[model samples]
Structures are given as C-alpha cells and as structure tokens.
Target: MGWSTKQIPSLRGRRALVTGANSGLGLQTALELARAGAHVTLACRDAGRADGAVATIRDQVPDADLEVRALDLASLASVRALAEALDGEGAPLDLLINNAGVMATPERRTADGFEQQLGTNHLGHFALTGLLLERLKAAPAPRVVTVSSGLHRIGRIDLDDLNWERRGYKRWGAYGQSKLANLLFARELQRRADAGDLALRSAAAHPGYSATHLQTAGPGQGGGVGDRLNALVGRVGNVLLATSDAYGAQPTLYAATHPEVSGGAYVGPTRLGQNRGPIGEVPSTRAGHDREVARRLWERSEQLTGVAFGLPAAEPVAG
Candidate 1:
C-alpha cells in the first residue's frame, strides 16, 4: 500500500546523472532510474568500480542504458571537467542527483584546501549543480535532488570558518555541518529558481540509516586498531539497525521523479526517528529554513567554489 518503486512513472527519454553511482544508495538510485527507462551516467571517482556497477545493473536490467564518467568531487578541476564534458554534449539533463558524499573522517583537506567533508559533501555538489544550470533549464521540467542526512539536525554553519581554519575539527560535527549545508543549498537553489522564474525544482532527501559503505569508509581511513574497531561497529550497525540501500534510495527516487514533490521539499522515511519506513515529506531543523543564513551560505559557496548559479537574488521582504 505504501509508495515504492512501483509508483515510479515511466522515465523514457529522460537523461539522468547520478554522482557516486558506483555502489550503495547511488547505485540503487541509478539502477531504478535506468530500469524506468532513463539513460543514466554513473559519475564516480573510480572508473573500474563504476564499470562493475554498470555490469551489475546490466545483469538485472539487460537493456539498461548507462555510462560511466570520472568525477572526483574533492577537486574543483575534476568537477569542472565533468560539467564541461556534459555541457559540450549539448544534451538536456532531466535529473541531477547529488548523492555522493563523505562522512565522519580523520581531519583531511580537499585539493581546494577545504575540509574534506564539507568540500566533497557540499561544495562539490554546489559547483556541479551551478555549472549544469543551463542543461537543466533546457529540460521540459528539470529536478535537482540532493541527498542530505538526519545528522544535519545537529549541524551549525560557521560562516567564519567553513573549512576548519579557525577552530579544532570534530569529524562528526564537520560531517553534520556539511549535510546541513546540503539542505540549505537545496532550499536556497529552489528559492533562487523561483525568484528567477525558472522551472527548476530543487529538493532534498535523507536515506535514513541505510546500510552502506559510507559509515565505514571514513573511519577505515585511519587504518589503526581503533579505526578497525569502529569500522566493525559500523558494519554491525548496518546489519542490525539500518535499512537496505534499496529501501534507502526511495526518498531520493521519490523526490527525483514524483510529480507531486515541489521545490524546497525535504523527503525521508516516516518512522523510527526517520531512520526507516515509508517515504514522505518531512520536517527540517529551524536553521534549515533560515532564509538569511541560506542566502549567506549561497553567497559564501559561490565565493569558495568560484562557481555562480547566475540566478536572481531573493527579493526584499515586504516589511
């Protein structure tokens, strides 16, 4: 009785690009979209793994239309490269799923000198979406679905030190900040689209504790006994407490293809602290809806990434 992949309408002729589509949630999202008749480009950091994912999806959907493209989100040059490649093709992009991200990890910085979590999870997607604005606008109805996390509830944006330059970094807090930035970015993007009278829909979704490598990838980086133990715990939690990645991808799929979903909508599971259950629109933190903060973050994102959305600014409030 609940909404599932069965509810996904035919996606024939639509062109989709899913970041981090080599495995887990992104892979599932790509597979389902391909099954629904979309031509999907699996944008990933590892070409081999992406090929493996493509083979796996082909095993299930023999006629699935898919391609692999290299994308390393931590580097702005890589982001620009992928965008430029797509732009040169002069094809309309119907769906852009900003699903690839990093979690809590030992302190690391991206090639752009940004903290790893924020850079990969937030800034990378920011630049990619902005760069792809024209292609998305070309579509009859373009949708941008960004994947955030429930952990975003605990996040606070430190506009003064987004890259961990001014203070000590707690990995989890840094991850939270990045995820919060995702929500704000999605909503702010929608606001700008509406202000500019563009037919672009920007929405955000959370997977709600999906069993994926995301949990272990960060901790495993340290390669120490404690890190190994943490990875083990993450695996254990995945088995015991998390939903399958297929189930987890529903919120994103819903946001991406569902006609009823609107700009600025946030989707997630509807039960158990939003960790697992049927998909539905969900509430976000009050900060998630703060217009001024979203505006400031938008401007800051442009400055940091050197990528601009080129949309009109939010209108002055009628006070």
Candidate 2:
C-alpha cells in the first residue's frame, strides 16, 4: 500500500468501468485491471478503437473478461445511455474510473455547447458518475477514481464562466480548470458519502508527465497554426520529460484498488515534485479541498448536468 503496483489486491469478481479506454493512459489502466482479474468495461467513443483495445488486452491476458461500449463524454445523452445500459446488466459496478479527457485543444464547444475540455473532462464524467451511483453503491466498498492532474495547482475555477463563454479560451488554462474540477468532484463525493454514512469512497489520481498521446491528441484536431504548434511542443516535452504509460498508470491503479487508500485521498508519483516515480499518497493543491468552492461547484455541476446526487449539503471546513 505504500508505493507499488504489486500491492494491488485481487480484483476478481469485481466489475470496473473505464472511460476513454480506447488508447493511452485509459487503455493502459484497463489492460492492467483486466490482467488483475476484474471484468473491465471499455467505455470509449469509437467502436473500432474500442475493439482494437480489447484485442490488445486479450492478447496479453488471453481470457481477459472485457466488454466494449460506446461513450462520448462530451454528450450528456451518451453518458446517461451508457449508465442505463450498464445498470440494466444487473451487476454491481465495483469501480468507476473517470479517466477520459481531452487536453490543450483549440477552442470548440461540446454537443452541449460548453467548452470542450470542461465539458468532456469535468461535466461529462460528473454526470456519468452521478447516473451510475446506484450500481456502484450495490457493490462492496465501491470506489470512484477520478484522474486529476498536477497542473491543477495553477488552475482557477471561474464558476461564472465555467465554459469560458464570457472570457476567451486559453487551452492550457481551460484544461487546468477541468483538471481542478476532477479533484474537487472526487473529494466532494467522498465527503458527501461519509456524511451520509454510505459505503462508498471516491479518490483522485494523476499520471504526472506521462508520455501518452494525450499531449498531442487534441491540438491539431481543430486545424490551426497555434494548434499544430501546441501539439509539436507537447510531443517534444513528452519525449524529454514524460514517463511510460505503464508506469504512469500505477498511481491510478493504486488509488483504485489499494485497500489503504481512503476516500478523499490523492495518489500520485512519489518522487520529488511528484512528477514521476513510485505511486503513493502525495500532497495536492489546497484549493482542491477548498470547501466553499467545492460546495458551489457541486451545486453548479448538478444544475448544468441535470443529474442530482441526493447527498447531504457539503459542510464548510478550513483548509
């Protein structure tokens, strides 16, 4: 439980749902979880990509119990549909991994007309988690592991412009905001669950400086000089500073299955600056645990996504 992937207990008989499991970190997370004996649902946007991911994992784990499903986090309709379908399966979902996200993309809106990063990264997963709460609660020691980022330290939440409608978008800034929301939601969920005495826990993790395709996944998807430049720079940085996606996944896996990790806890690389190393509980931004901000953000998310989590109101706490 201190800092090793080998510490992950057997996940047999567990059902895990991993969003954006088509490629990169999400795929790596799913592959490992499947190898660990959990039945994994690969919730991805593209069917072809999902199929490929499943094949790749099966090649390794041969009989890996896996299912491919469609999910586009940008659309609330898709989130609801996926949740409903999974709920209909009549099995407890032991783990909900909200790992899908876009990063450093050009300005664009989602199907819901919100900024792309915030829409997919925060709101989409927010709504999905809420919709699936029932299935999660049916399982023993059910957990929610939302992937956040170290960049959240520099992020600011402008609740008024959560989607940057009034203010113009800065891609990294917007990405930061969404990442901040990930941590806030994770911690707030844990707080609410504890207050209600529910047997559920939520935690967040970050794959610090992982060399995944994520850094370049979004920039050029919009087709612009700046977008291309961002992608190039990101790729360069990945080559120079990022760790392997396999290693990148340890913190996430640790948080998801490690028995010692408590609700509201954060797991990250244990080295200096928490950039890349062993997985362990690391210090996160104080703002991530800001009570007033978390409470307001939770309410606003409920209003925006229209997925009400019938938990008690969050109580204020000093940071």
Candidate 3:
C-alpha cells in the first residue's frame, strides 16, 4: 500500500557500490538494489563474506548482477586502492552507499592511529567518497547515501580530541561522534555540490535499531570483553526492540532510490521515536543542518583523511 522496497523504481542500468555488504543492513541493501535491477558491487573487508553475500543475492534473484570486492574501511590505503580500481575501470557509479560502520567498542586505534569507530565509520568512507567523486559525477543523476544513527543527537565534534588522544574515550561516545560525523559529512557534501554545481547528490539515512552483527563483530572484531558485551546486548536488544535486517535497510534503500529525495535530506523510520517503522522523511537535528559546522567538519575530514573532493564550478541562482 505504501512505499516499500518493492515500490522502488527499476534501476536497470544503474551501478551501485555498497560498503560492508557482507551482512546485516549492508547485505540487505545490496540485495534489494540488485533485485531492483541495479548492478551491485559488494564492498567488504572479508573477501569470503563478500562472496557469500553475492551468492545469497544470486540465490534470491537468480540473475542478479553482483560482484564482490575487498574494502577494509579501517585502512585509508584500502579505500584509496578501491577508488583507484573503480576509477581505472572507468564505469559510471550511479549510487555510493556509505553503509559500513563500527559501533560502541573499547578504546583502540586504527592502523592510521585514529579512534577505531571514527576511523572506520567516518574517515574511511570520507576518503572513499573523495576518491570516487569523479566517477559519481560521470553518472547522469548520481547519489551518495551515508548511513548515520540516532545517537548523533548526543554527539559533539571534539576537534581537539578527534583521535581521542587528549581525553579518555568512551565507547558509546566515540560511536556517537562517528555517526554524527556521517550526517555532517552528507550535509556538507550536498552543500559543496550545490556550491560547485556538481551533478551528484548527497543524502543521509539511519537504520532504526536493525538487528545486525555490528555490535558483535564491532566490539571484538579486534577481540576483547567490550566486543562480547556489545554483541550480547545487540543480540538481546534485537529480540526486544530491533527490527529485521530487511526492515532496518529500508531507510538506506529509500535514500538511494527515492526519486523525490533531495540533497541534504535525512531519511529514517517514521514512527515510535524513530527506532523502527516504515522508511520516510524525518526531521534532522539542528546541528546536523549547521552549514558552518558542516564546512568545518569537511575541512577537518580532508586534512585527516588526506582526500580532497574537487568540486566543480557552482551554478549562479537568481536573487
């Protein structure tokens, strides 16, 4: 009756790249896109898992156009390599889904010495987007959909302690910061596109407590008690409040394919505190729409990730 994944328009000729597509929301998003006739690339850290996801999608759609590619979001080098590889292919990317992320976990640093959550959740995707900007622009109506979280409400971008070097890191706080950065990045990207007259559109979405392995795989993907607790709570909470991975993926799918979606718009569940429901437009936080903060975050992200997005000239608007 209402707009659902099945209602999404056909994407017959579109090519989509979805990060963390091996499981959970990412996998569901990728499969749905493929089912809608888009050729999907499953970008994941584990080649085996990516292969499995491709297999699963093929099993369902039978003729689904899918590919598995390795992408470790925690590593800048990996992001760069992936971008370069995609660019070398010279294929137009119609959709870019910044879906892979890490959740609350113990204090730790990535190979680049960034807080693990921030590194994988924000920086990795930041760099990847920058690298793929040209390919996105090559498309007729490209869209970049970044997945954020409700925890962003409590997040404050600590420029002085971005890496959690000066202050002690709290797992939830770090996760919140990363998720908040996601929203800011999407907004800033849209602003930049408008200013520079880029054809690509940027949008953000969040899964309302979808049951995923993020909690379990996140905390201990590096191995620790924090991982155990994260996984345990995620599993338990999933039973009580979390929705199915399919339902959880609705927001992202909507953001990616909805023709009415605008740049800088945020999408998520439309009911019950935004934790679970049908995918629809939702109000974004004031902070999420702060142009100044978005600009500053963009500059900081460029500096931190060393990936510059070269935007085109802006179209002048009549006053």
Candidate 4:
C-alpha cells in the first residue's frame, strides 16, 4: 500500500520550517507535519495570517507545536532577518520545506527590484536555504524539500533577462521559470552536497494541479478583470481537473520524511498528468536534469541573491 500522511512515522523531536505556511499547500503541509509530532515553524509574510493558520492547526491538533514568524519572500532583507532569527534561536532544523511562491501574477518588482515571481519563488527560498544550511546540517539526516510545479516543463531560464526587465513578461512564463528554477536549485544543491561530502539531502516536489489560493492570491488578490478570469479558471480547473490541497501536499510530505527518498529525486502525484493520486517518484524535465544548467543557475542565483552555497564548487563543465 502506498504511504499517506497517516503512515508517516512519528516526527517527535524533529524541527521543521515551512515557508508560505499562511495558506494553501504550505499551510496544509505544516499542519500535517505538526500532526505527525514535529515542531513546525510557519514562516509567512503576514503575522496575522500566520497566527490564524496556527490557530486553525491547533483547533484540530490541540497539541500542535507551532511557531509563526514574519517572512516576506519578495524581500531579501526579510529573508535575512528571518534567517538570523532562526539562527539566533540555535535550534537544529530537521526538515526545511521551501513551499512559498507566487503564480501567474502581473508584472511587478520585488523589494529587491527583481521580477516578483522570481524574487519570491526562487531567490527568497534560495537565500533562506543558504542562511539555514548550518542548522539543517546540524540535524540528523537533514532534508531540504523544495516545492516546484508541473509548469516547469515549459520553462526556459533566461540568464540575461532573469528579471524580465528587458523582455516583456508573460504571467505563466514567469511562473514557469520560477518553478523550473526551484527544481534546478534542488538538483544543484544535491550535487554540491555530494561533492562536498555533506550529510544534507536535497529533493524537489510538485503539488501538480491542486486547488489552492495560488491563482487567486496572485493578481486575483487585488480584484480585477484578470483576477476574475483567474478565479473563474481556478473554479473550473478545480472542478474539471485538480486535486484537493490535502492530496496536493502528499508529495511534499513524502519528500520530507520518506525513508526511501534519495538526493535529487523528484516526487509528485501518481495519476494522469500528475494531477492527483498517491505520492510517488516522477520523471523530471530534461532541463531539470541538466547538470550544467543546474550549476549555472546556481551560480547566478548565488550572485543575484548574494547568498553563497557554502559548499565546495562542483567540477566545471564546458557549456
């Protein structure tokens, strides 16, 4: 039988940090981990929303050990602050889930002046992982799970125009690029870990087409024509072809705790188009598997975010 959340072994004494835990897949993932006996930190931008999410989790799992911290993924300063706060706490992080992201939003600049989606989805998590690497490494069998998306297949990493400043941005394209970046970062981190002989394990997961606030939370949060259209599509998408948020979070939970998982593995739903079903290993895009591309993206990410990998460099290859 396939493993579900119930099958997950007790995570007592484990410490977990989940980004974007205020809603959607992040919130659900954090709650499930908490239920499994892990002390979870809900890293979110809004303190009020995070408190509410914690309350909801506590309502169901009265003993849920939860902490809410302010983290704006679109801002580098916020990322740094969050990292510093965690480091100051001096707690070992067993699992770090990079679950926060933006999808299909209008062109906007982040606090760091990068394109909004890329900034929040990729750079923010990139820096967070770097900043928290020490605590993660301190934990026994430390794992870093990054939540990507199926749209990664359609993504192309534009090295020159990473921020979409020169080229006009399309909502889906930007979102796809960020998701692809997530996978690439995971792969590259795995490579670095292996090359440096580090104990940390890095893997990636995709929720597939789960009914989440991602669509509406993007441009739709403001209430406009695009928002209305996105909301309509979201409703139709959920009805016609999408999984529940609970099901969507399966891959992430699996990636974080599955004993059989290895570094660089990608997990998602097992079903038509990977939209729904039990969590299982899935094939990644050729781009996602390209070691050279992964390395280059890693370097660029480090440079853009000003966060070093803190691991030995991988063997350079001809591009």
Off by over 4 Å in 2: none
**Across residues 121-224, which tens digit of lDDT does each residue of candidate 1 receive?**
99999999999999999999999999999999989999999999888988889999999999999999999999999999999999999999998998677888
| Candidate 2 lDDT by residue in tens digits, 16-87 | 999999988899999989988999999999999999999999999998999999999999999999999988
Q: Looking at candidate 1, what is the lDDT of residue 220?
A: 72
* TM-score of every model versus the real structure: 0.98, 0.97, 0.94, 0.96
Candidate 1 TM-score over all chains jointly:
0.98
| Candidate 2 positional error at 108, Å | 0.9
Measured on C-alpha atoms, candidate 4 has an lDDT of 0.90
Q: What is the Cα-based lDDT of residue 100 in candidate 1? A: 97
Please give the ranking of all candidate structures by lDDT, highest first, separated by commas: 1, 2, 4, 3
Which 10-residue span in candidate 4 carries the lowest summed lDDT?
Answer: 214-223
**Alpha-carbon runs more than 4 Å astray in model 3:** 220-230, 312-319
Candidate 4: the clashing residue pairs are: none
What's the count of clashing pairs in each model shown? 0, 0, 3, 0
Give the local distance difference test score of model 1.
0.95
Residue 184 miss distance in model 1 (angstroms): 0.3
